[model samples]
Target chain A: MKVTLIAGSNREQASSTQLTRYMARLLEEQGFEAEVFSLYEHQLPLYGPGEAYGHEEVLKLSQAVKSAQAVVLTTPEYHSSISGVLKNALDFLNSEYFEGKPVLSASSAGGTVGVSSLGTLQGIVRNLHGLNCPEWISIGSDQRKFTDEGEPADQATELRIRKAVDTFVHLIHRMYG
Target chain B: MKVTLIAGSNREQASSTQLTRYMARLLEEQGFEAEVFSLYEHQLPLYGPGEAYGHEEVLKLSQAVKSAQAVVLTTPEYHSSISGVLKNALDFLNSEYFEGKPVLSASSAGGTVGVSSLGTLQGIVRNLHGLNCPEWISIGSDQRKFTDEGEPADQATELRIRKAVDTFVHLIHRMYG
Candidate 1:
């Protein structure tokens, strides 16, 4: 089965994207076909109600998510919530796209703790009608967590990320495999 | 004194923008120079931390908000919170831009009641160090609340908007005038 990893930031060299890459590798190691959908490549127009939903990028993104059996979402916390780029991408989709799919929420923040964005993402995922995995990954002071090559710099952080990924993968198998 | 009204959606003829226009007019009627800054006209790049803040549109938006003594922010509720476009615009700014400025929050939603986006906006404005005016305007069933010309269709809704604008203007004069 295919599991999509969405990197929720457009910034080049973002820690969130690094985490996404790491998660994708982990999922691949677990025998799943994993694809990383980076927002850096998509310059989606701002979503406007009543406007034509004809953006090629949005359509492509919608299709990718729809085809995935499960998704792992990673975002950089901005202003104590998920980044705008991630939220904007979600805005392009509706409950129909995510309904019944399992989503694993993850985030990275500059602070010592990364709890604030979890609630926001949970609320948004619920609104999208996606089943959020009970296990989540949050890396605080994220700038110090990753190396220049986008790999975890510390073993402890890497272990935490693997644990979260394992739990999400287990849930996916149990629920939909 | 200048009071900036930010229409927090990119949809052409959006009810959020209509409400913003209405609020701008009310502020003008209250003897304040009010300008409406519609997101429909801006195509800002997604914000990236640690990246060079060099976008011309972002610079222009920052300058506008900095020049204003007060601001009235209106957004459309999406996924039970403020639209991503609005949040993206805020991400481009920091506390310095909105510090000490009084902000009046408003929103429109498709549901029977519009309360979801209010808390989210309040938290963001406070994080930016802006004083959020206690009075807020929320127009629910927004599609039915406005006429073809974008004016409030009913006297009751118009009255509510005017009252909220009046309260906001009063607070602006009291706090920053």
Candidate 2:
């Protein structure tokens, strides 16, 4: 099973990136092939008709989202919501792209609201007809959640991630099969 | 008086951009120095810690936003909210960046709900400490509502634009002066 993790954190050392990486690893450990597409690496133009008219990068991005079997999005909570880059990427995509897709939306940030943006995003994805996973894994601003090496630091968070991954994998199994 | 219009529409010929340009011209006609910062021209990385550490481009963007006396943001509604690129640019800004600045949020989109995203964006900007003009402008999607040159075609829409600009300028005068 191919699982695409869309990492929305715009930093090299972002907690959101670390969280997405951890999710990818957990999914891989469950015998699923997972790849993360970091928003930082993509040359996304401000999404609009300009880019919609065959911008090579936007085309590649749309194809990536379309081809994914199961999609996982990790975004930071910015001003009580998800970052704009993640939102921009999503804006360029149509509901047809996510129709029947079991998408998992997760968020992490510096404060206590690890998943504050999740509620807003969940509403959006639901509007797009995406089958969002019931349990959203939000890693609240637990500064000690990540190790010095930027890995998940706490055992409890790690275990929680494991359960989220299993739930995601099971959903993919039920939907795609 | 200075009114800097940040055209958030990424499209080469978008109704929102047209409205923004029209608003800028109208402001200039009213004896205010108006400038339009097309999002398509600005090269900002997605907000990240890398930029937070004073990346060159990030510094330039920060300075641009800080120097503006008042800002008019024109965005297209996407999935019942503002576009991601605009949101990303806002995310990159510090809270104090718009702390005491007057802002006018407007939208032009295809759906009847195109203006719906403006309220959400208003909430975000308010959270960021911006003084938003409560009387917002929204153009419902109609190809005929746009001119051959992409300016607003309807007389009523033009009247509305004038009223919005008048309100925005008044708000800036009242708040800043």
Best by lDDT: 1
- Scored against the true structure, residue A169 in model 1 reaches a CA lDDT of 82
TM-score of candidate 2 to 2 decimals: 0.49
TM-score of each: 0.50, 0.49
- What is the alpha-carbon lDDT of model 1 when measured against the actual structure? 0.80
Question: lDDT for each of the candidates?
Answer: 0.80, 0.74
Q: What DockQ was computed for model 2?
A: 0.01
Give per-residue CA lDDT, model 2, range B8-80, as digits (tens).
7667776778888888888888788887877777756777666353766567667767778888888988888
What residue runs in model 1 are displaced by over 4 Å at the alpha carbon?
Answer: A50-52, A142-144, B1-177
DockQ of every predicted complex: 0.01, 0.01
Native-referenced TM-scores of chain A, all candidate models? 0.93, 0.91
- The segments of candidate 2 whose C-alpha lies over 4 angstroms from its true place after superposition are A148-150, B1-177
